[model samples]
Target: MFSGLITYLDSIRARDPAPRSRWEVLFYPGVWAVGLHRVAHWLFQARLYFLARFVNHFSRFLTAIDIHPGATIGRNFFIDHGFTVIGETAEIGDNVTIYQCVTLGGTNPTNGVGGKRHPTLEDNVIIGSGAQIIGPITIGQRGRVGANAVVTDDVPEGATMVGLKARSTLVPAEEWIKDFIPYGTPCDEPCEELMETGAGRLAELESQLAEMKAELAAIKAERAQPIKRNGTDD
Candidate 1:
């Protein structure tokens, strides 16, 4: 357990720019939440239902990051900014990074039956802020969920997902692991400038098209007029 705690702290230190010392990491909400969760999960497995629930509830109240004792989370997991929610059946693998306001929630909340109602995230998964991964979908390893994306389907390995319903595009795992993107969207610096340029060019092309249509109408009007021959009235 101590080894797992050390790994979790190391993960937070490596990923997050803040926290220079062990004392600071000790004060981190994520660290405390995950640590408390380990103990609670053990209690849950031991059939100490009340104790487990109490610990989980206290952790939630303290951290603002709700993680059920029933959720199975692996080592080196990091949750940034707090306010994230992991459902009872949600499963998280090792080296996972989850940002603020992320939810691994169920589509059917009121069902009391025993089944996989929450999503599962594989190792090295990065979930951005405000991203909602609903249902019992499984996100593959090295997958990235962009900010504000709503993912309802299974994500493939080493893929980047973005948009409302979300779209997936494959990426090299080595490159993604090397350079970390904050929001997890693969839009580079040039892409932003290119988007602005494209919009301007589209508006310019529309104006030119309208001018050409006006000239064509004028030419057609001139051609429609009857040509009168000299010394002949028709």
Candidate 2:
């Protein structure tokens, strides 16, 4: 247990920039929640359901993070601020980073029973703040969920997901390994490169605008012409 705690501290330190010392990690709500979750999960595995819930409730009260005891979480799971919820039957893989207000939840709570209800996050997944991953969706390895995204479907491996409706674009995992991206925004392409890529789209919009202007001018010219009145000048 001590060794595991040490590893947890190391992982949190590696990811979070605010913590200055290992001792400070102990005060972090995420660390507290995850540490207690280990104990709760152990009791749950032993079939001590009541005891597990008791511990889980205590952890929630203490840390303000709610993680169901039945949820299976792998190693190196990091959570930022509080208010994160991981429902029962939710499975989280290793090296996952979840920010505040993230929810791994079910679509229909009453319908799912004795089965997987919540989402499954694969290894190296990054969930940005206020992201909601609902249903029995699988977030593939190295997947990124952008801030405030509402995802109800499976995300492919190495995908960068964004928006409320959740659109995704592939991002090479190798590029992600080079640097940490904040808010899960696509940063693989530099600003200049992105501008260069959008040149065609910009031109298309300009052409459409020009066509609209020409049509407007033609309408104005036709309106300006004298109106014919009964085959004679008015």
Candidate 3:
């Protein structure tokens, strides 16, 4: 693959170049790699199956990136060129930017006779390049997955996930997110809060009423008792 040679060249350049201008002419292997990927996909779509397949294999060998031709990708699917891998079953949303070294793969390696082996990204989800989303979980609309996070389960709508197992750390719309289970601040639901407060107040008032009735009964009992004797003859 051309990418492999480029990587080796880049590495050698890094080591052998003069210290003053070592990185002056940095070569980006990823840009051409991604651009080539798009072209290969285009070839396949245009019915040049054999050439497309060859390009795909070669690209992977060189760039360490393997994008499945069958994967449904929307508009503006840009990935920073590098060791990136996208699975055959991966479904990418529109305007999604994937950085280098990201993996959208399956747990069992073959997509495992899939019913839904890869993650389904919704619209406007910004995955900080290097995020790995595996399994058939649904990442809700506008969710953000932080860099290098390993996601295995479903993420709630408009939430931000970081760390391993991808726990929802923040919800952009607090009230709309109730599935935040990991260090998530309670969503602000004014109506729900008001209902709870009202219910609590009602219980307190009922207790106060019961206590007042008991006091009134005690006073009446005292008045009806021995006080009658004081109202006697003299």
Candidate 4:
């Protein structure tokens, strides 16, 4: 666990998350999560709901991640980076990898009815950052969701979903697949001025097109006008 911290600190150039150096009590995030979640799960099982939530909140605050008490996360569930949030009623299968900004959320808010609203993740499911999975859906085993994808329905096992309202893409066995699709992790600067210039030009052309259309309409009206009163052609 201490080594996990070392690796994590090395991974990011930001400030350290912990000051503890004791090897005995120290644990890696994977180990810590597995261990702590077991305890939290027990607390939840024992109906210590409030206390479990409190501990879950603390874990998330300290780790920059959050998992709700009502969530049933299986063994070896892993999360990387910050801004990951799991809903209370979410059920995660074993070996799920959740990246940053991923949300396993509830679809329609509960209006006091006691039914399942959160999505269920099957084993080995991997979710990329900024992905939203809503509704009482089942993401089948080994299913992968791409970055920024918004899912509201069921996904079959081993299927990959992408785009805004994510649709599944069937993958062949030969393809090299990754748990999380790489997106939005860029630190390099982009050509903003060039993009802005192109946008500006497009806007200018649209404005010119509108003006030309107006002028053409005025000319047509002028030509369409019959000769005034007595001046009208017989």
Candidate 5:
């Protein structure tokens, strides 16, 4: 058990560089949250709903991280910071890392029946801060979600998602080969290039729009001119 705890701390350290030692990691709210959640999940599995909820509430009160007792979590799942919410039907696989203020939220079903409404995150998935992963979507293995993204659809394996509606960004092979990316975003030269290209396209479109407006104004001016009879104004 001590060995497993050490391994978990090491995993967190691998992801976050802020901690100097394993003892420092012990003070993290995320560590306490996951630890208490284990007990809550065990009680939930035993059919002791009230006790499970009690533990869940206690953990949330202490850590500021709300994880439903009914949620299923796997080994080495690390929450980098606090203020994260995991819904009842959410299932997380091994080595999944979630940042602060992320929500593994569920969708409301019209049938009034509780089923798989939350998301399923596969192994090695990374969810950035403030990301909302809603519905019964499956985030495939090694998938990366950027900060503040709102994801409602299934994400393909090894895909990097960004933006408000969470569109996939094509990552270079070298970047993809890396094991972990902070905040689930690859802000390398490729990303910079894409941004530059988008800016250029926007500028081009604005210039075209300005030219079109000028042409329309000239046409209207020509139409408003008085009619002429044999080159003389009417």
Candidate 6:
């Protein structure tokens, strides 16, 4: 058990550069939150719902992280900072890292029945700060969601998602091969490439618009021409 704790702390250290030592990691709110969540989850599984809820509330009071007792979390699930909420039906896989102020939110069932309402994070998935992963969408393995993204769809494996409505950004092989990317975004090259692509698309659209205008003008000119009767001008 001690060795497993050490491994978990080391995993957090590997991801965060601010921690000077494992001892410092122990003092992190995220660490406390995960620890307390374990107790709450055990109680929840044992059918002690009240006790589980009490523990969960206490953990939230102490760590400012709200993880539902019913949520299933796998090994090395790290919440980097506080103000994160995990819904009841949320399922998180191993090595899933979530930054501050993220939500694994649920949607109301139309049939009024409880089911898988929250998002699922596959192994090695990273969710940046303030990201809202709504509904029962699954973020695939190695998927990276950028800060402030609002995702409502399933993310493909190894994809990088960004923007308000959260669209996947095309990442180069070299960039995608990295083991970890902070804030789940490769801003330098990928952003520039997107800009260039957008510009090219805009130019292509403008060219097509010009061609369409020319065709319309030709049609109008042909229609406006005087009609001829028996080869005579009318």
* Top-scoring candidate (lDDT): 5
- 10 residues in a row with least lDDT, candidate 4: 184-193
Q: Put down candidate 3 lDDT per residue, 1-234, tens digits, no spaces.
A: 667545634433432333244243234454445556677778878888788778888878877778766566764454545678877667878645566688888777564566667888876566666788888877777677777788998888777776676666533355444322212223344322344344555677889999999999999998777534566833
The clash numbers for all candidates, in the given order, read 0, 0, 2, 2, 0, 0
Q: Score every model by TM-score.
A: 0.77, 0.79, 0.54, 0.62, 0.84, 0.84
Q: CA lDDT of 28 in candidate 5?
A: 94
Please give the lDDT score at residue 142 for candidate 2: 80
State model 3's lDDT. Answer: 0.64
Candidate ranking (lDDT, best to worst): 5, 6, 2, 1, 4, 3
- Weakest 10 consecutive residues of candidate 5 by summed lDDT: 191-200
On TM-score, the stronger of 4 and 5 is 5
- In candidate 2, position 221 carries an lDDT of 100
Relative to the true structure, how large is the alpha-carbon lDDT of every model?
0.84, 0.85, 0.64, 0.68, 0.93, 0.93
Per-residue error at 222 for model 4, in Å? Answer: 44
lDDT of 1 by residue, 2-59 (tens): 7766766777788888788766887888878888999899999999989999999999
Model 2 lDDT tens row, 53-86: 9999999999899999999999988888999999
Model 1's TM-score against the true structure: 0.77
Q: For residues 83-126, could you state the per-residue lDDT of candidate 6 as single tens digits?
A: 99999999999998999999999999999998999999999999
Candidate 5's residue-wise lDDT over 1-234, tens digit each? 999999999999999999999999999999999999999999999999999999999999999999999999999999988999999999999999999999999999999998999999999999999999999999999999999999999999999998889888778888988999998977675753455356656687889999999999999999998999998998
Error of 4 at 214 (Å): 38
